[model samples]
Target: MTPTQRHRVLALTPYARLLSVWQTLGIHTDHRCVRGPDTGMAMVRGRMGGSGNAFNLGEMTVTRASVVLEDGSLGHGWVAGRNKPQAELIALIDACARQQAWARRIDSELVEPLAEALEEERQQASQAAAATRVDFFTMVRGE
Candidate 1:
């Protein structure tokens, strides 16, 4: 593949990583729920705080991207938020799906680093939270 093709393939690694992590954790963000062209806009209905009756959250703008490979194959990706990476991933995955030759380059250079970075960030956040942990105790009263 040419340098441009390589770069394009590389660019999609993070999106794959993000999707993988999101799926692994079972986080119910709009990223995983919606699909297709209408993915960018969905009338999500859910309880505000798990107490009140269900309500429509109205139409929220989302991001959806697709890539068409040289061989006329397509791969699609989407996320609820306006995260650029999510859109880019969708496009790249589409490209990769269409052009299987680019898959190895994308997986090694792009996907691996994206996953590593995310894992590192998660670890740091967890450590930070752990550091601030507090202990509580109660004293017995004598009658």
Candidate 2:
């Protein structure tokens, strides 16, 4: 089947746990937020006595994430800004929830690469922190 067909099924799979694995390994994305133009506005009149004007100026912020599989299938998820991880996790899950042959390819290729990258980052961070190790001492007053 086509990559698109496979992606559709993978998109429905339960892959939220993958995101946690990624986070544990330190491979993560920055927060992404989207705000649409306001659709409602208030009218204001000139203090000197002029006609009032009305405009649209209402807006809300929406957070989302996108993941592309090895076979080129893309998945996206929208969530609240406070739940950025959830959004990314959902996106990845959807990308793997498909039943197409391409889904297996994507899991092996794309997901594997991502997991490796995350693990590498975690190791680097650990090494860096270790390099800054310090020891402290306290005096004995009873002596």
- Each prediction's Cα lDDT score? 0.56, 0.50
Candidate 1, residue 36: lDDT: 36
**Which model scores highest in TM-score?**
1
Off by over 4 Å in 2: 1-62, 65-97, 135-143
Per-residue alpha-carbon lDDT of candidate 2 for residues 1-143, written as tens digits (9 for 90 to 100): 34444333333333454444444544333322232211222233343333456444443444466777656656665543335555556565555545364356555654555556666777999999998998679878985
| Alpha-carbon RMSD to native, per candidate | 11.0, 16.4
Q: List the residue pairs that clash in candidate 2.
A: 9-97, 9-98, 10-96, 10-97, 10-98, 11-94, 13-97, 38-58
Q: Which 10 consecutive residues of model 1 have the lowest summed lDDT?
A: 25-34
Poorest 10 consecutive residues by lDDT, candidate 2: 33-42
User: Per-prediction count of colliding residue pairs?
Assistant: 1, 8
Q: Write down the TM-score of every candidate.
A: 0.53, 0.35
Deviating ranges (above 4 Å) for candidate 1 = 1-39, 44-59, 83-89, 137-143
Candidate no. 1 TM-score: 0.53
Candidate 1 achieves a global lDDT of 0.56
